[model samples]
Target: MSSLAYGSFCATCCNLIPPETEPLACSTCAKPCCWKCAREPAESVSLFNAPAVICVACDAAMDLRGGGKMVPKPPMEQGLQRCRMHPERFLNLFCLTCQVQICCDCFVVQQDHKRHTIDSIEEVYRQKLLETVEKFREIPKRLKLVDWEAVRQVEENLKIIQEMETRILGDIRQLFQQRTAIMLNKTAEKKAVLQKTKDFVDRTEMQHRQTLESIQGLNTNDFLRLQAALNERCESILKDVGQLQVEPVRWDDIDCDLLPSCKLQPISLNLPNGDAAKEKHVQIQLIDDCGIVWTTTFFIGGQSLALEMKPNRQLDEFHFKAIVEMSHSSQIKVSGKSFSFKGFLAKNELISLPKLNSGGYLTDTGDLVMRLGIRPENILEESDLLKALLVQQRKLNSQLKVENATLKDQNFILRGDMLRVSSESQQNKETLETQVVALTRRLKMFQHNSYVHNQTLQVRPQTPISPVSQPEDDKEKLSSDMQMLRTKLDEMKTSMKAMNPFAIGSFEIYRWSKDSKFYSPQVASHVGVTIYIIVQPNFACEKSSDVNAYVCWAKGPKLRCQIFIEVVNEFEDECVREDRVFDFSKGTSFTWKSVISHYNLFRSDGFLSDDHLKIKFGVRPAVE
Candidate 1:
């Protein structure tokens, strides 16, 4: 036989060996391998009849062993491959920080992996595979529970949406019903007023026809006798017509836009006195939605009475007063623990009603009811009206003169007060500054002393000189003093700010009315400088009414201001404007009258729109 030569290389170590030396060959891969690189056949491979050793590579290549022919393992099951960056080395470690598999070379040499936490791939695989299998097994149950919860949530949300929709729809319908009721009530009121006017007109017409017939049938002698009476009757009829014309039954313009509705709360009243006969005074109050209170006080005497009506709150622009005579017939009723008053009210006159023991014409929930009628004697002649006008004008002029004088006095007082306050503020500021400076100097001295103490202690550690506890004590005391000084300084600064007079602020603009005259609230600036405007309605005046603007220097130093007044139209672009420069010195308030005509304010083609008079005011410091 030819000498056995080294034929094939061992599959495990790839070493050449002699065939005659009986080198092991793998049954699966048919690769020759050295004895150290061989492994016994699996127990399931009993058909081979004899035990055989296979090369390590052939054993590794077989994924499922023993029962069948060699089956190659999948790429994933072949363990970690070489790293992409460094193909020569196998990827043995996983980077926890980077979440990537890296070889030993990449982990040790690459800058990117320097800070990354690395774990062996086999260990990570063993942990992650078991966790993944457990999680995979739980997926179905978790998905089922999540799906059920989502469905339940969807159902609940749908129910809530439906309920909200129902509630909103119900609210809308209720609002409409309420609005309709209000409209119906207002219509009925208008109808009643119109019916009353119609009845008055019919009665007057019938009387006039009867008088004309009597005049036509009268003889010359009778006519002369009745002429004076007939003339008086005619004049009375004409006066009635004029009065009707002056106060017509006209519908008030209603705004369709919705406004916040206020509940009609019951008005609380003070306990009533025993009876109208014995009571010396009676008070009645009416409060509006805007918190305005109108009070009427009745001073009762044996046969005479005085009624005083006024606003509970002080008004800036206008005041109201009415003087009237009371008739003996005016009376009050008290029964069932309720108070009721009924009286006939005329211009400067009142006729009392009969006292009721149990019941009377007690409207307004048995409160007070006044069925007042104008007395015929209240009518005035043309000459009398003229005289009244002249008297009113003279009264207003005299009142203005007096007010001007009072304002001058107030101005002088304010000037003195301002000077005193300034002096006090200056003194307080100086005192605080001096205190702060002294405290700062003391704090610096304490710090210097402590530093010197610390240095001496450092230099003379063995010296018998007791460490000066005084420096530490002094330092703590100085720090506390500094803190107290800071607190006092803050308080002083706060007080100074409170004393400042030039600060500016604003408030809400409000509308008010008295005796059919419209007015604006007194709008004041931060320094207590204020302004208000009034529109006075006068049927007899040339322009029907006069608009006035008042500027008041209620407090603070004298100021020169430019005041701009505008009447804007809600429906139109055009507006009526007036501008004036006024010097408000001392505590004087200046009034500018007849700045604009009332006719222009109320005219259909003018500034008033939607029955609303929009007034705008612009106040600025006047140029020197």
Candidate 2:
């Protein structure tokens, strides 16, 4: 208050503060300065009373006083260094607003620093250093622990690899043994046949020579009989030898399922910058899920100019049975890029971005962030709801089978009862016929006698009434009752036949696609499952002469399925059919090759109708 200025520069920013802001003066030199340069000097830096509000020269003097806990002098603050604009004054105060050190003249004269805030540079540096040291004190200890963990993981891997190597070598040796056994069997069988043939030839020659010698001393009839016998025996033996032709190669015996595809290694990755909103070039690291300190790099940036994952090591591999999702704003949807790999995804694989469906994906900060969700595909999984449905259906089918068995048992019982009733009716009818015949014969006799009597006595005697009416009535009623019972039994048998189902369910696949190779859409029905027809339509085959079909099923509650795939002609008759009892317990696929000629399947008026192939597929529980 000793001297007042209308306006003054701030020592910090050198900006002019207008008269209304009310600038303050330095405590020592009485130099007019903005209040901003004082840094609200009346308040405490750490909830305590500040000593005083002074200029850079006063702060430097105070630093030289008794201050313990000394620190290294920075070049800018050493030896009372003068400010750039003011040569006489020292630079000890830090402009908090402008982030630079300034002297008293800069605060009193400069217009830009007029409204800036300033604080003691020493206090700010001291507080920041203490916080930094405290935060990083235990980082070294944690890092040492991490190093130990890495060592343990490497050891585990080494042990696993050793076990794997031994097992694999054993498998290879076993394969060689099996092959050797098969070769030995084939060679032994051929040697046996050759030895038998040589013995037969030698015996025949000896016999013929003996017969010739014997024939010279015998009759012509005996010689003729011996030669004829030799001719017939030689012809029959030669025919038997000719029947043993060379065996064709059996390719079906080649077991492709000997080695498993790969061990299941599941990994989940989130891609935040896949879309390349700001830069088209991007790269991401794929960490190994097996704790192998290994990583594959997927780069969209480099000269390769494609999104691909490259593994550094020869043993590195990846699999993509991935469920990819794209997120824009709050909406998330599947990218429709799920794939099924027979094995792990390997080298030179390209990745595609999840397409955005709606509005701009950029956030408030102009980052078009994309999120990717990844999951490996597994064929050994079943839908839980569908599995439950299948179980219910199976129970129902089993119940129906039980009911059918019960009906058959009842039918057999009814057949016995009907036989007994028919036999009784036959007996009754026979008895009635006998009675009627007897009565008629007796009456005829009586009539003859009566005529004789009439000649003698000249009067006709009364004939006793024949007793056949009751027996005849009983026979008619019994026959009517038997017919009614037979009708009822017939009705029951018809109902039982109708209730007995031959199969659990069936589906038909009749499809025609211009791009049949990759056009496999899912077909779902109330059968509580789905079917996907992935086709390989190759009409032109120069090397192999027929067609092949393969079907894969994700695992579920194990079942013994009898599956039949038939190629149906336009007339609804089976052109060809493949029937097999497939054990669906394993999570693997079944294949049928060379089932039908390729030409017959796709040609006009054959199996194809309107350029479409019709297949009737059926599945039933295999008979135990």
Candidate 3:
């Protein structure tokens, strides 16, 4: 370290360490010197590890072993030299066998390793480096080829699988459609069967209802008599109890155990009915335990009848006949009577005649009771008989009640059967629904497989194989020969409307007649001249003449005949007149139109619109 001293006199002072305390020699010179005048020694260039020394006089360096200063030399002077045996003077080569650097002369002329390959040193180095780089560059291309080959195989397999899936799915779809159709058909058939069963049940129920109603109404008179008898017995018992000073008891409760539950037996019959129009006769005999017997004889008109009776049935072999009067109003009477044949049925009877009432209304079932002598002439006797008939009525009422209960039980069973059928139908419906769901799921899976196959086929490249395999050519031909059935379903819905009625023009009457015996002949013509208008054969036509009218013209030589009618004058003598207009435009084919005139044409009273003249037309011609 050197120190600089400063003082008030402004003179510079240098400080230096003495060698005894610290080394003050220069690093380069190794000489003790004052700080202000010290100099650095020159650098040594020796290639030896000896301590360096410098000459201060010449400022030169010397090696420790007395050698000169070191200097960096060019390659030619240090080591790079041409081979001795070759003419080349450069060393830019390699010894191939020895793998050592050499000049071109050594590479070509060295006999010991002349057969080995030799090249420029830089060229060999570059070639080895390029080879290493190229080897690394080829790896990705090889890997790509492997990947493409594997992908191609995978795609081909997928394509084949897809084709198989497509075929299978097509079959599945067809099967589903067929099954759906079958299910629908089965459902329809089941519905039809159900409807038929329902109809049967309904019909049976109606019959039961009718039977119950009939039973309820049976022997109402008998029940009344029994009630009266019961009341009389109760009254007598009450009187006896009063006499004994005892309390009256409830007879109904006391006798409840003794009273048996009544039962009913249905009636069966073999009927004897013959054709009424062909002079067939009917006879019925009713006998009671008291030997009171009744017999009836009847003659029928078609299925309808006119009947006569001997109400005094105790007579032996009574015979009677009647004047059979028939009417168009569904009313026929041997004499004035109203009767029905619905009240005379008995259980298990072989009736020899169709049941008939004195009143004449027929029933499909011949259950009519003969209510004889309903006329006012025999009212008293008929009343008495009706009264006497009430005695046996109570038994009929009990029988009817039991029958009704049995029918109700039968109806309940039928309802249970109906409910069970409905439940079965519902179960079938649910099963069908489940089947549909299963099919849907299978279809979806098939669709998914098909999609996957399609994707594979799209990505895959084709192979150059023949369509048919060599061994399967015959089998493929069979596929080609399969029958192709093309089915076309056509549905036609047709709705039909009702047709309008046919219309005809007004009626035309060519001729008419009027006589002196007629009263108010013109008014009679107006009332009786029915213009039978035909709107249609089935539809009734309006009788109004506003539709059209017609006139009647006489058909004769020179048209001299005019339509006429006879009328009475103030002198009570007969006069011929033509008063009304013979309108034809208002006439239909079935309608009639007429105008009246006198016996001669152009008579004073023969005006077409005059009164006191009658006109009529029929199929018959004018009478003489």
Best by lDDT: 1
Better of 1 and 2 by TM-score: 1
lDDT (Cα, tens digit) per residue for candidate 3, span 370-406: 2332121133433444455455456677788999999
User: TM-scores of all models?
Assistant: 0.26, 0.26, 0.19
lDDT of 2 by residue, 1-624 (tens): 222333445543466657566554443443445545545443333354443343553442111121222333334245446777767556655678887777656776778778788665555566678899877986887888998999999999999999999999999888878877876787688678767767877876786677557767777787676787767866876676566443322222333334212222232333345345323445554443222222333433322222333333332233334322323443332222333442333334333333221344334553433332233333223233235446767999999999999999999999999989868755764554455455455556555654554465334343458545444454465555545545554554444334322232223335433324532343322122222333455645322213344343433346665555465666656466776665555444533323333534545446655455554444544432
Ranking by TM-score: 1, 2, 3
Model 3: runs farther than 4 Å from truth?
Answer: 1-388, 465-624
lDDT of 1 by residue, 1-624 (tens): 011112334656766554445444444543445544344444555356554443365453322224333334323325557678877656757899988887766866688899778776655887899999999989998999999999999999999999999998998788878878877887788678778888999999999999999999999999999999999999999998877632222112232224322222222222232464445666666443334465656555444334554555444333222222111112322121111121222222132323421234334333443321111112232234335546767999999999999999999999999999879976876676576567567657666766776787567545347555555566677577657766765665555444443323222223334346555554536334566665554444332333443333445457776666666655546666776777667655464545555533444555433334556665555432
Instruction: By lDDT, rank the candidates, best first.
Output: 1, 2, 3
- Give the range of the ten consecutive residues with the poorest summed lDDT in model 3: 488-497
